[model samples]
Target: MLDFTNASKLKKIEVNYQYDKFSWDHPGSSAQLIRDGKPKDAGMVEAPLNEIDQVIQNAFNQKVMPGAVVSVTRKGITVKEQAYGYAYRYLDDQFTEADQPILMKQDTIFDIASISKIFTTIAAMQLYEKGKFQLDDPVAKYIPEFAENGKENVTIRQLMTHTSGFEQGIELYKMRASREERLKAVLKHSLANPPGSKYTYSDLNMITLGVLVERMTGQRLDEYVKQYITDPLGMKDTMYNPDIYLQPRIAATEYQPWTGRGIVWGQVHDENAWALDGVAGHAGVFSTAHDLTILGQMFLNDGKYGKALILKPSTVKLMEQNMNQAFPGNDHGLGFDLNQGWYMDGLTDVNTIGHTGYTGTSLVISPKNKAIVILLTNRVHPTRNTESINQTRRLVARQAADAIPVAIPGNKNAWFAGYGDQKNAILQAKVNIQKPSVLSFLTWYRMEEGSDIGNVEISLDGTTWNELGFFTGASDQWQEQSYQIPEGTKFIRFRYTTDSTVNERGWYVLQPQIKTDQKNIAPEFTSTDWELRNR
Candidate 1:
């Protein structure tokens, strides 16, 4: 007696704060294990598991650095946590007792640099949630001094989204004689672009935000962050200034020529932030992999932890929304960078959010999938000539993405069949049906020039082919097209023909399937061979 009608639906559980609020210390339940029996094994990711080790090994092998730290989590489970290589490479070469190799640890503090902006943004958003300020409110409303230099109307949202039109950067470390002077310089600076007309990523925007937070809260940026965000969240290792006692454990950074700062170990690396005494909204925060993972997970949980609503869900959504639509691929969300495929390759979706640091650190959060990847590296140590770690970032994220299985509609894997080489003939595929049925085909294709044409065809026999439709394949973007099969056709085949000798990669086909049930008849194929020819 099979009781098919009484099958129960799965229950949803709330496990947002199963781990600690301030740190990733909670070894929460595994997201993969929980979903093992689901229709699509979404939990299974194909990351090399050992790829983190390979990245570390290659860094040292290439002499890019001596060590690095990596952490990844999905849904609430910490899938990978690793530290590789020596924390102090110069010590290994010296051979002295005090210069012995120091292995990197899970809690190793990294000068996260620009990745700090996310935290600063979170703090600002917290104030916004409290009604301390509205996003479109003029900056002069909070800091009257900022009204100087015809910049009175710049809104808080503009600063958060890098649409303030301020200059890209200022060498405050070189120009200002004092911290007050530096703050004054930022306030008085005028627009480089029209406000909100374009996205010009400016450290000045965040630096101005830091000043605004102070003016509104009557507190230093670090003090404000500690009281409201980190302290309540339990991120003890996160701060603008690392305790002197922890200096020995901090990873080293660039040895700057300015001011003869020998080796920037355990200190803020940004010159302007250093001039401000190691506290700025745009940079100068130090934290660990464990601490950052907690922050990332908080966002994954929709701005809550253990019954505490740190941010309204709507607010978090606003933070993740892409505001710079004018700039197609340059995705920017309020205070957070979004959809950056170069570093966020596998981790990016419409809701994927994260930021990168100039000093070689990145945090990617996928709220839709509940995944996070944290990579910390001292790529600029000893010198800044090391290779960019963007490829490694992409590989790690791609591995995580590959692990999540995609659910096909009919429990059948989709097929992509297409043809076209650079030179002569066209590339195509064919399908045949004996009676009326549903046919669906989708292809993401592009070509080199305007003459490039790739088309779809349905034929009855192997000899003669009839065109179902034709499309200009020269779209700059991957375009999708579909067609239906007519009744009483014995065979159907698809063909892709390119018009010119260009570097053509053809098209990517997805989920091509046919439904045969007559009662559930598929959509009609309005095109006959003659109609297609006439068109």
Candidate 2:
């Protein structure tokens, strides 16, 4: 039998490398301005990024969406930009068009749908920075009519965070005929819950925000976004509605007959946004993948892009801070979703933030790693009843995350705790001790907050163990940790538990040592699903 705890007679543990070299730059915090560069120039691995092409091809093969455009940027470099499949493939819900469908191009424009909310948010923040209004100020203060329907107490922050009492939405396309009447219906809509009492996602919040922006700036939402956002950033291809001449480059969307629209193409797919002249706060922005990467890079750069200061850095920080702490699992910043792993996948951390559009669009920004990942598709083309593209979203995000390697210490392999939802992995070792000692190790982790957990435990009897320390969220870099070993301790272990939900990049451990006043001890560990490999 091998001595589980021996100081000098034990063999040295060996490790293996899976890559050329491990990078130590991630989950990093350096923000670089967006520019064009190759994947290797950004310290990203090309093999994993190459896998992204096949994922998109598989989605196209399965008809998950008629087409898709993807963009990935790291360290301010545009590493990957590609397009796949058809931009317009169907004539109606049940039949393909008889004509040669337009092929997807790198510059193809997409109906970004709910991603428009971020634009509205940026426009509102501009006014707020100009001292036009405060976040805590009630919407009624600017748009006085919004005070109707028991919403007098709903503040601008409540609306941005979706904690206001407003209902999800009203049937503007069905209940109203004109834009003015639809606006009235929204202003007078009733509450579904009390203000600040719960977090309920509702388009009424963004709709109200759109009206507020217009009321404050005396310009329509489209004009304000164009002048303050798209124009300043040189996003010529991004807009609320494309002109007739630009229809050739736009993607087709749902075929709607209820609103007297047939084979909806080159226009906003959202019926409510269409009723509102394709400029509502909740939906109706259109842009190509390259244009959105610029917008995302601006946010990652903290409100500045290539000499244009679109928003104050302070305001950007405020927007990045999670405002919906009262509600767990639904973390929301001012207007962006924070650390949502459903779509963010391994890219998710406490500070990783992004949003998804109903039209098969998702954008993830990792400020820590200074990276941006954008995936756009028109799954609603021809119909809205197609299969969900959520799995593809998570897969692409994970691949982008894998492209950024985690630097291993001394360029050696470390023990990796496997990753998956509902995981319960443990690495335990027996210790022989009669007096006090110290246990120390180096570790790095990025786990789903409040769901995945890593714990260090010690036991005297083996049947019962006491937690020495536990960690959640992320350790932006590798850290050295030490704990005093209790007298009579016989075993020590690292137990990582995760709930049945989002799984992130898991825990890594290396150089575990037990020390006494007189000598050093090496441990022989038994692990469940843990392996030694350089990631």
Candidate 3:
């Protein structure tokens, strides 16, 4: 094993980045800690916990890494914290022994892989408050070698935004053994595309960032983070290079024949991070579900956790604000990935932000809904080819979201598009009507882009279906839609359709009204599948 004691011997470089405390830039000091008490009424009744439990149990039955830990929080209340299946069923190449699996528990520690980047980003932002660095500074200014191979213009912001034009990463394991050689190769590597011209997620961006932090402060990445972050947050179980005594409590991940390591556990799983003696930027941090709940709550509380102040409210705002708008759907902030639908699922909304790890871990925080959900699993255990656990991620996120009621009680009844792989759930009402009638309702929806859709149609003679309009976008603020009821219309139908793929956030229609002969009449909206919801 490479000596980790030589961290101080790493080359010292000039720091180019600098931060200024401009009046407009100050998001002000962090907000007060908001402690979670008993579950407060947020209008939501019950979380769809049965669905989530079923998903995890199904994963266990399917042999998807044997076990997992899922935690869900909504409106400052801990909704769910449960463990499933086995933590370790086997240590060999295959899970051969069926009865030897280690039982999973709620408090098992997990290697959070790429999710560690969020911690690094948080640490960097803390230093920024101390006037350590400006975001736009050139990488070459701090590390002179980064100027090589047409990379002099790469800025700190680009690295965080994932527009640094770097490829995924260099296989340092296949290259020479020295850390400096691998780092130099990384800095000097040619760009696959022009900087800021595109967004390509890469490990090199955060790796170089780890290097920059070291260069600026002469502190090891883990040490700096521990002192400024985890310790303050009281995340006792979150750290790098966890003690030998904690190994039994840690989830096992991967059986790596490629690295000649059998049953990789306790240590960092990312090869590049392992090359750096388990202290790299892209991955390395390990955490428990309970500790992550504290972290997520801190973010929701605007960077304050209990008595410890980690970041300013303004800094957290800046981190959640989109910086990769030019890349459209790839919404991102300084360090957090924003609006990712793959794992975030129903949790993704206007202010949704979080990160995912390669070892079947996910974190989603929705500021708009006052929610946070974490799913940690050792999906790579016993083998790396195990199928993805994305469905489980989506299922848990959706369950948490369902806890937040979308019902509007005052309306008595608003059309509720029950969330599922709905093919075409139509709501139709038969009513006595004349020429020049008006069909109106308050409508809001978050339909799946280009896949799921909602359509409004009218049947004049109650035989032929005529398309009135279709809704295919999202809105944080509700919208009002009105359709002119075709003359001599006897029936109206609100058709909400969905694919067998991802489900929509489901539509909400309030105040279904009809106007006939100068009379605005409240008519019963008939439904075959859609249900009336009272918020």
Candidate 4:
């Protein structure tokens, strides 16, 4: 029901904002810099309609579980929806794209494993937007039973951010006798670490939230989710429990060894949630790529889908704000994983939000970029022993990011400078200086293995170098160092050498400048500053 006209106007404005932020060099020209090959023009780089199809064909071609479905959207328009592989490989019935196989159709339902947390999170935020609850409100307020075992102080915000200090996981299916007992066990369990000390992604946080929603609304979590989110957003296929008629369209999950649940198909694969009747806040929602796209767009639209405000714009903003500041790389927002380099490849760092399901599903949304990448694969089928589909997820998301031509044509992908593996061989970058001029060079560096003996050197040429300084190498501590280049230097170079063996991942560079006179400003020095140095 959204007005595409208004959305289009808003998208144009947003694109301009991003273009400025990224300092994109051209309007509508973008390139994907292949390490060893010529940069490909993203606008013309054609592959399969769905980027995941390409990945599936490459990595998961031999796997079972029928097929895979992937979809990507930008500014409310779906750019791709592709299916590959089999919906039921062993079945004698030949499958085609038209058949809508259990795992292959555009609308085929998927047990989105932990992706259900996003729905629960949005539902909770909706209640908050309606003034039904406060983010800081203690869970004990709605579910008094949750206050037991020193958990009276656990706030809703903590649960959403996975900072409640609950244990990573609990096998409710094996430990508890019944659903009621499982619920009781969750409420009675104590914290593994002090609350809010650090992020330990836990299912208990959301399980408790599910209980809170049920207790407050006098409705099951699934019912509340349907009435508030799915129904209003017109996501007809998303639900915690599907009818028998829909089972044939659902993809298979795991072959559990302990729960006696053989080859879980058309049922929630999580053992703990399965014990709780497939309706927990952390997991157990079944949906399709199309249905999930609606939710993705809602977040991209800042919580308004059509006329209904499922969540306040402010609440959605808070969900995208990083809460794991103390823990640097483990970027997390309220109920959303963020700034994940491995999964959110090529997306804006601060503006993108996404989460991955254990069942090989991932959703990456970049509101600022008006982009969404959804890859749904049942890599857990036949077995859950596979290491991780992170590479595939990253590749697909990067492909989507690459597809969006940067407003500027020649801007290079952001640089990721890190220490090389060779302890004795120092990483170096050289900049050529043609004429005598006063130059300012800026360097950003951080040490992975904090060491007091780490030092940097600047060289006029490859033979002789001058020591910049020494600093204790500490993880995640980025220090900016600047210097002035002396006149008459033919070339300048930087070397990060360590007296003691230690690892580091940071950057060194020369800042760009605007020339006052109409003379050609020779390109600056430093490895990252050079256009085509090492390659």
Candidate 5:
């Protein structure tokens, strides 16, 4: 029921947001929740999900990351879970491989960098439900020092949505005199822009939120999270500053000589979080793919896992609602980033929510499909300088999305515009129409509006083409489109063009028929990047 089709323009271009389908309730099977099952048991296609292993292996083969662990679930069923490559590949900054490198396992823990914010946000929500503080209340009310330097008017909601106008970060590792002064340094930092005027993602916002939680609950952030969230959900492998005994199973992060921390392992990766003694709101939670999926399933279950109810169903709805309406494309909820096609990709929708970590970690949940994707990697291992894992995230997410079949009208085969970004692709067939005729076909698409677009065109001589109609956003359903073919038309084609950026669930066309005065003709297609697919 979340529709942005008529919402205001996104930056320079207009967007019409729509979903392929709609479902208010959890779209899951009637089986046990979060249990291991085959893809089809959850109404998912197995082949697409099977492709995930090769994708992760390719990342390892290319050395994009040292290791990775992935988990996928649909309709409350865990369909895929696997590990790849090495957890501790390098020994130093010179890319020295460890003599005894630890191979990754399904239980190998990872430094899930910024994902800690979601846990902090959930804890804060619990306190909010307990009437500890109102969201609109100024931070100055609870932490008096926050009122300094133009921050008195900043509300809790603004901080949660990253609109407090705080700078991204100040590098507390270099700025702080001691670990004791870190909080003081953060409290005294000045605003970069007037709050409520801009949406700048800043670690300061979540750090401050962590401090607020500690102040209200009279417990450390890690202690509070373990007691309230992790412990109750039975996420045994998730924690802050993982213990010494767990180091052998933990993945290594970047090697930092500047901070005198060589080959960061068995500890927090973020220098700022380390400055805070490996516990902060923004980072420092180490977890495995299996454990993270439990947390994800909790959200898909409306904040409940089994008998434990972590949040009210209404609260979860509020957490998914977009609060930064003034900033068009930067949609955000209480904690999670919303509708981010950059990483969410095919799973990106008005209701799809997710979060990403700096150390190559991501969690995406689609409420409509009742699906969850967890991709954890030690991409920063040996060094922070490496290839971006954004595409890998998108491809894996798209695989999970493709597994959920769209109901092909009449259950017939359809032409799929193969997924990619920054390309001009065509699916065309030479047609000899001596007289005027009507061409009709069915299409279903959800693309990046104003950027990736699909067009139906015809050419008199198969070279110069004229557009008949175009589509950019979601079609909502399989829509039948008809156009009049001219007498001299020689080529009928569907051309799809995309910008160099995020890709969505690509276009699908089915059952093309041309009706003349005599009879209906079925045309054969020669495509550049289209596939004949059965949805």
Candidate 6:
């Protein structure tokens, strides 16, 4: 009976992929799989990341580097395993002396830069499900020297959706050439536009798809991603360079005194994947926040794990859908980067996929909350010009998206729209309404569309306001709203206008009625940035 009603296997997994088209909706609710220490054997709920461990110990007490390692998982339980501050605190790049360092643990080790292009786009979709080619086949159909220059029409789905305008890497370590002449100058680099037209986040398109998966598997792209993706998912500490006895739980990154490679611990820190010898499919990998949460639980199990399937839950639901609809907010997916509320903050929806790593990492998976949220950091340990781990990657993805709980209807009270950043929230009421009134309730929202919203105003004079509707998309569930309160309306509200970006699971209101013409007003309300919780 474990079919779990597959809902026709999620409608054969992606027929024009529509998880409600995108205002966010996914896993909506269902997680159970944690064993022993039991998140009640998986009815899930443990996520107390003590404000994500005090925002990674206040960004390592404002030094911003010197260590971090976080892990989280929701549905399959292991809630949050943390560790912060110095995985090998300085002995060079002059973080001045104290080299007895080594504390951040729950399994240290992380370079994870460019999240190694989604493990080389999941080892080229496990070799496009072993049929080998045709993702619109074209990087000159398996590197015929990548069709020199005009890039012979770039494809493999526009290099897994960075939209292939290619121009983000090839600095092949200040070019003294040879790494096959900087990979043939990234196959004759030129087009920074016009190749699926826009979005250009390239590392020479995954170092030419890791030399077209080492020329379609003559081996070596780290031995075909450790023999078919991390030794069939066991991920023994994730790889791509680990010889020198894992160097005391490896962490440190950047201290490269002009490529004389001063202090980059345990190798691989993206000097164009350490000049290509470190296995580059765009940044040499090195993992461990629970070995990248077992590859984000094999992408929330769409690609199976335990009995190891590799890929194909309709190609892992086409790698989380949104293939750059003409680059709208760059929500890629194929190498996963969908719904990025700037580092998946408040866990931006569209089926939440993730990837971030230029030394200070990020992973976030949330496959509709079958969740995962990594966050590995060395922030650039000794030095890479710190400042900007994008606010601890949006505060550990808004504390694992405010520990996922917004849906308080029958379990009691509601009316909460409180997240932060350039905020403004409301909940006012003073209705005497001498004539027409209707206002029933039960609303929901998820802002950040053309810059946040959630309004439902009206006023007579408690400060002139007017629009009685507007809640920017992403209902993902609740809805039963109404409004029409004209005649003598004394005032009524529910505002919530933000813009300092990324907020979801924010707006909600519940069971409020109000058929007033005078008597049944049921007023008694007046709040700001809104809340009346019973969470």
User: Pick by TM-score: which candidate is best?
Assistant: 5
Clashing pairs in 4: 25-408, 26-407, 26-408, 26-409, 27-407, 66-86, 66-87, 67-86, 431-525, 450-473
Runs of candidate 3 with Cα error greater than 4 angstroms are 1-43, 407-411, 449-451, 461-463, 477-480, 499-504, 518-528
Per-structure clash totals for the candidates: 13, 2, 5, 10, 0, 3
TM-score of each: 0.73, 0.84, 0.89, 0.73, 0.93, 0.35
Best prediction by lDDT: 5
lDDT of 4 by residue, 126-245 (tens): 777778788888888888878888889989999999998898988788874877789889998989888788888999999988887777788989989989999988888888878878
Can you write out model 6's per-residue Cα lDDT over 106-179, one digit (the tens) per residue?
A: 78878788888898988988888889897888888677777776878889889888787777765777888667
- For residue 479, model 1's alpha carbon misses the true position, in angstroms, by 15
Give per-residue lDDT, candidate 6, residue 402. 66
The residue-level lDDT of candidate 5 at 521 comes to: 94
lDDT of 2: 0.84
Give the least accurate 10-residue stretch of model 3, judged by summed lDDT.
Answer: 8-17
> Compared with the true structure, what per-residue lDDT tens digits does model 2 show for residues 1-535?
1112331221222332122211223323343456778888988888778889999988877778988888999877888888888888888888568386888898999999999999999999999999999999988888888888799989999999999987778789877467878987898887899999999989989998999998888999999999999998989899988998888798888888897888888889998999898989999899988889889888877787776778877898999999999998789998899989999988887788898999899999988777889999988887888777988898898888888878887887778887666888999999987887888888888887767999988888898988778888877667777777867889999998888667778788887889899988878888867888776
How should the candidates be ordered by TM-score, best one leading? 5, 3, 2, 1, 4, 6
Would you list the rank order by lDDT, best first? 5, 2, 3, 6, 1, 4
RMSD of 4: 11.4
Judged by whole-model lDDT over C-alpha atoms, candidate 3 comes out at 0.78
Q: Which ranges of candidate 5 are over 4 A from the true structure?
A: 1-32, 175-180
- Candidate 5: minimum summed lDDT over ten consecutive residues — where? 7-16
Candidate 1 lDDT at 243 equals 81
Which lDDT tens digits does candidate 1 get at residues 1-535?
Answer: 1112322122222211122223323334211211112212325544445555775676678776666888877766677778877555552222222345567888889999999888788888988888899999999988888888777888999999898889889889987478888888888888877777888888999999998888878899999988888887778899887888897688877767674686677789889999888999899899998788778877876676554456766788899999888876667888888877667664555568999998888899977567788888877776666777776676666566545433332344333222223333333334456665555554443343344455555555656655656554323232334455565454454444444222232333444456676433322232111111100
lDDT of 3 at 404: 66
Worst 10 residues of 4 by lDDT: 7-16
- Model 6 C-alpha lDDT versus the unseen true structure: 0.75
Error of 1 at 5 (Å): 43
Clash pairs detected, candidate 3? 18-134, 27-314, 407-535, 408-535, 409-535
Q: Write the per-residue lDDT of candidate 3 for residues 269-338, one digit (tens) a residue.
A: 8888888889888999999998898898888877776666788878989999999989988999998899
